[model samples]
Target chain A: MKREIPLFLTAVIGAIVLAGFFVPHPYVSVPADYLQRCAVIVVAFGYALGGANLVQVNLEGILRRHPDWPYKLVLLAGMGVTLVFGLFVDRAKFQDPGTVSLWIYDHVYVPMNSTMFALLALFIASAAFRAFRVRSAEAALLAVSALVVMIGRVPLGDAVMAGVFDHPGLPEWMRHLRLEPLQQWIMDWPQNAAKRAILIGAAMGVMATGLRVILGIERSYLGGSD
Target chain B: MTISTDFGVWIAALLTLCVFSFLYKDNPLYKFAEHLFVGVSAGYYIALNYWTVVDQYLVIPLRAAFDGSQAGGPFQAQMQDYRGWLIVPAVLGVLLFTRLFTRLSWMSRWSLAVVMGVFAGLKTTGFAQGDLVAQVQASLVPLWIPGDLWGSLNAILFTVGLVTSLLFFFYSREHKGVLGGVSRVGVWFLMISFGAGYGYTVMSRISLLIGRFQFLLVDWLHVR
Candidate 1:
């Protein structure tokens, strides 16, 4: 009965959501928006559960005298310290001001994130060197396009290629002709097709899941009903 | 000003150093900073949602429902008629929490069903127009090109690339002689597209990391 009910509900709800899109009535749309808002809250709660799980697993490792126990302790300490500072620290007059959370976010988080990203410039250069071999026709096309785009982005390319200029140079022509046209073609064709395909797949998945939930075919959430 | 600016600069330096520590095999201080980040982030979201959505929209208005004077609550004064519908969602939101209780868990579906059905209905027509119809329309092009040999060949290859790639994804048919060859070519296009997409994704993530570094160096530390 428990399983059957969920499956039935999922099917019905799935159909309703699909139907609601075309129905064009406030009766359906309003309810759907409200449900979506509630889902966000529920998802937020799920994140809380995830945070709790992180603490629990890490703390357990520390208590068990695991080899990497010090790292686990560091993790727990970090979590605890941040939680304390955010929840308890005064926002208005912290000397450093802008809420303790914001202070951490702006000063600590953003810089770390940017530094990590800057490291990618090194990785990209290395990867490009490895990928630059002319093995296939497609490879040659990619190499040429990449080189043009890279050179076009810099001032040095224009200085070196100045002899080939009809007022503005080869870089300008490449940008307008090769890069712009290619970008336009991609936006016009392939991206659209892929997006539609993905949307259809996602919509189908949502319908199937909704049906399972609404029709009572899926009782995974019901915690072993007797 | 000096004190506040100095503190900001110091904290920014600490964050920068902690982040860069990852380059030198992960260590204790780095782990500590990472966890602290997650915990603080969670708390902020909780506070933001409770303040902005729940407190502002739900709880205050529900209270106003009982207050006989129909006019003077914070939200009721602002929104008026829309305030009543808050009950429906509030009830549904509460019902979601009932998943914690085993016997009454089935009620959560009422909320889920309503949400999914409505979004799908709302999005279908627009998604079809924007993502499907427009895309297929753009794919169609005139075959004749007047100017040059290279231009004509480029146009032909581009058309072939677009159509064959689309056909390669078709699950309904078995590809046999010519169709098989076209589909094989389609696979190459898909690989390049995937590779390019992967590279772009990597670039985006790295850029985000660089933004963080720049923030620390320029804004926080005031380092040129």
Candidate 2:
């Protein structure tokens, strides 16, 4: 009875949600809209679940006195501090630019994210040196394009080449024909195609998962016993 | 000689040096930067969620709705109507937290199911119109261009690439003869596309590193 009822509701609701796209009637549209609102609330709940899970695991680790326990302690501290400030801390006193929260985000958070991303430049340079060999026709084409882009971007490429070749020469033509056309081709075709595929897959996945949840085929998420 | 200019230059130089260190090998300095990243990101997301909920949902709307508190407030009446709806979501959000208590965890599914249904409906419409239909339509372009031979060539090549790629993605069909040949070509195209994407990502990373270097050298230090 427990499973059947949920599954029946799932088939009914899921079908209606799917049909709502085609149907313009208030019956479908109105319920669908309410369902949408309900989804947002549910997703918000999901986030809470995720947050609580993080806290629970870390807290448990700390309590057990496990290795790297101090880091877990720090994680708990950060989570607790943030939550307390969010829920209980007086909002009025920190009204301006110099609030503790704002200051932490700007200086601590932003810089830290920036620095990690910055570290990837090293990996790129290494990858370029090792992987950019012209082994085939396609590889040769890619290598030439990469060289053109790099030369066009940097001043050293122009200065060094201008001395050997024609002045104001290779970089300008490279920029006009190769770099521009390649970039345009990438943006117009491949990117759009990939994005479309992802959208389709994601939409289908959402429908399947929604049906699973509605019909009670996905009772595991609800803690299973019921 | 000056403090601000000197500081900028020093910081920029340090960042540049740190980035350059990657050329040699990974070290503690890299790990330090990485850990700081993890810590700060976790902190930032929590702060961001608070800001979004408090400002958009609770604070601004509540003030506008209930408080007849602002003069020249045309939105006051509408806000009041909207305020009532907030309770539904608020209650659901609270119920979501019920997962923390094992006893009441079952109630969380009600909220979850509603959300899944709505999101599914939204996705169905958006994907059909924007992705499935639109992508197919885009591929069905006029092959011949009036003036430019190159334009016509590009159009033909694009159509070929698009169709082959789609066929490659279809896993249900057995790859025995013609389909195999088409899919093999599609595989090559997909690889090249991914290589291009990787190249772009590398450039983005480099640009970010350069920015940090610039900040460390120009903003934090006195050196020119």
Candidate 3:
């Protein structure tokens, strides 16, 4: 009864949402909108539950006296402080200057996030060095396009070109051989085409997966225990 | 270098240093930052979700269903409207909290079902319209433009590239003969796309990296 009811509910919700999309009548849309709103709230409940799960797992680690339990304790303390400020202290949620929650978000979260992504720059350059070695025809093509894109995107490419070749003396066709235009052409033509094809493929995939999910065939979200 | 004296700036700088230490090796400071990041983000997510969606969508409306006004009493919505008929979902949402209890965790599946169904329905039609139809429509350009040689060549190349790329992903049959050749061309286009995309992404990251360094130098320390 437990699993069956869920499957039935899924099918009904799926049907109604799709119907709302196709039908466009108020009778369909009103209920559909309401259902979606309810879904959002329910999903929020799910999110809160996810947080509880995180806390639970960490608390258990602490209780078991795991080797790195102190880190878990720090994590809990951080969450507790942040939650108190966010949930109760700043319940109004306006970006008031006095809100400690906002301050933490700006000072702690945003900079940490920025620094994390900034760290990726080093890794990406290392990857490019290994990838751009150009061992095969396809790889060579990729390397050339990437090199062109990287160079064209910055002022360095144009500066180098201006230093090496005088634009005034260059012929009309030769002037068009600038890396900027060349990269733009590659992006507008081949890249656009590739993106379109990839999106089409992805859309087909989404359609299939969505349908499967709707029909409850994909039950992986329902854990194995029950 | 003149150092930042503001406590918040000092905290941010120290955390940034802790995070950046990963370039050398993972240590206690890095682990501490990583755990704190996870915990804080998760906590924020929970609080934000609860306060924003569940309260706005569930609690207020449920209140309106009884008292004919939202939680704060400023906004007045008629309780009898179809929108107020969220009782079933409210019940389901409460059931989701049952996940915390070992014996009643199975009840959470019902809420999960509703969430999945609606999202799946939304994404299916959304992708159909935005991705498939739009791209296909855009690809229907004039294959042969008169008088303009490059335009005509570009149009032809775009059409061929798109067609071959689609064919390359078609794994329904064996890749041999004409299909194989077309697929091979598709591989070239895909490779170019990937390379260009990576190159573009790396440059953007570098710009961000530069921004962080600028912050560290100019904001945290009065050095350039």
Candidate 4:
């Protein structure tokens, strides 16, 4: 009953929503709209369930004196404090600049998030130096293209290009050899064509997978092998 | 140079430094900041949805349905009508919590099934209309243009590139002779595009680093 009922529900609900697109009648549209709202509400609950799970896992870690027990305690305390402020405090006032919840978000969360990403800058620079070596034809092409694009996108590259073009006795055609224009040409033609092809392929794949799920041919999301 | 006087800014600056310290070496300070970030974000989202989804959409509608009272704000007019149909979703949302209990875990599947089903159906039509049809239409470009040599050349190149790239993915027949040569051209196009993507990504990461430096130098420490 458990497995069969859910599978049946999936097929029925999927068909109704799919029919609404083609039928466009109030009978189909209204039920589809209602089902969508239900889906949103259920998804929200799932997120809350995830938050609860986080608390449970960390609390267990703290209780067991795990390797990072101190950090777990800190995590739980942070969650507990934030939850209390968010729940008990007036909802309308919770978002005010002076509120504790807002303070934590702006001062703590924002900085931490930005700094984490900022660290990636250093890592990427080091990685690119090692990875962008030009040993073969494909590698040379990739490296040269990357170098041009990188230089062309930045103000420094524009300045360098302008300086070169300003040299005395330079040919008229050499004056037109600007990095930005070349970058634009590369992006607009070959890059755009390749991206479109990839998009079309991906769209086909999505439609196929969606059909499979709706028809019950794909049941991995149902959580067990059937 | 002057440091920020605001107590909150100081706390923020310290936390930012604590996270950045991981670049040098992982330590207790970095670990604390990481854990705290996760905890706070989870808690914030929980509160956000509790008010936005549950209270605003589910509870208010149910209350107005029972009492026939006008709920203020954007939903006021809808509240006046009082939808009895909303009860179904409310019940299903509650069923989602059943997963926490082992005995009732299977019941939660019903809620997940509905969500997945509706999304699958919607996505099928969405991809078909928006992506598949639109892209195919876009790919049907003119191969030749009158009185514009460069334009015609570009058009032909675009057409050739698109066809060859698509052929590269077709696995029904072995790629050899003319097919192999065309596929080789497709590989070069793909490589160039990927290289551009990688460059763009690096630029963005660097911009993020510049933003942090500006914050630290301009906002936290007064520097000209």
TM-score of each: 0.68, 0.73, 0.92, 0.91
- For candidate 1 chain A, the 10 contiguous residues with the lowest summed lDDT are A187-196
Cα lDDT of model 4 by residue, A67-105, tens digit? 999998888887878878876774756657778888888
User: 1 or 4, which is superior by lDDT?
Assistant: 4
DockQ each: 0.27, 0.29, 0.65, 0.60
**Each model's C-alpha lDDT?**
0.56, 0.58, 0.83, 0.81
Query: Which regions of candidate 3 fall more than 4 Å away from where they truly are?
Result: A128-133, A165-167, B68-84
lDDT of 3 by residue, B116-174 (tens): 88988888898999888988998999988899998999999999999999999999988
CA shift of A179, model 1, Å:
8.0
What does DockQ come to for candidate 2? 0.29
DockQ score of candidate 1? 0.27
Displacement of the residue A162 alpha carbon in candidate 2, Å: 8.8
- Give the per-residue Cα lDDT of candidate 4 at B66: 63
As a whole number from 0 to 100, the lDDT of residue A32 in candidate 2 is 58
**Cα distance off (Å), candidate 3, residue B142:** 1.6
Docking class of 2: acceptable
**Local accuracy of candidate 4 as per-residue lDDT tens digits, B1-224:** 77889988889888888888898899999999999988888888887787788777788777766674544532332312326667777778788888777788788889989998899888989999999999999889888789988789888888887888888777778999888888888887777788877777777878888888888898899897
- Per-residue C-alpha lDDT of model 2 across residues B72-160, encoded as one tens digit per residue: 45232231234545556667777777777878776665555555555555665676676667766766778799998867877776666
DockQ of candidate 3? Answer: 0.65
The alpha-carbon RMSD over the true interface for every model, in angstroms, is: 5.2, 4.7, 2.0, 2.2
Chain A only, candidate 4, TM-score: 0.88
Q: Candidate 2: where is the Cα deviation over 4 Å?
A: A1-28, A81-96, A124-226, B1-40, B58-86, B101-106
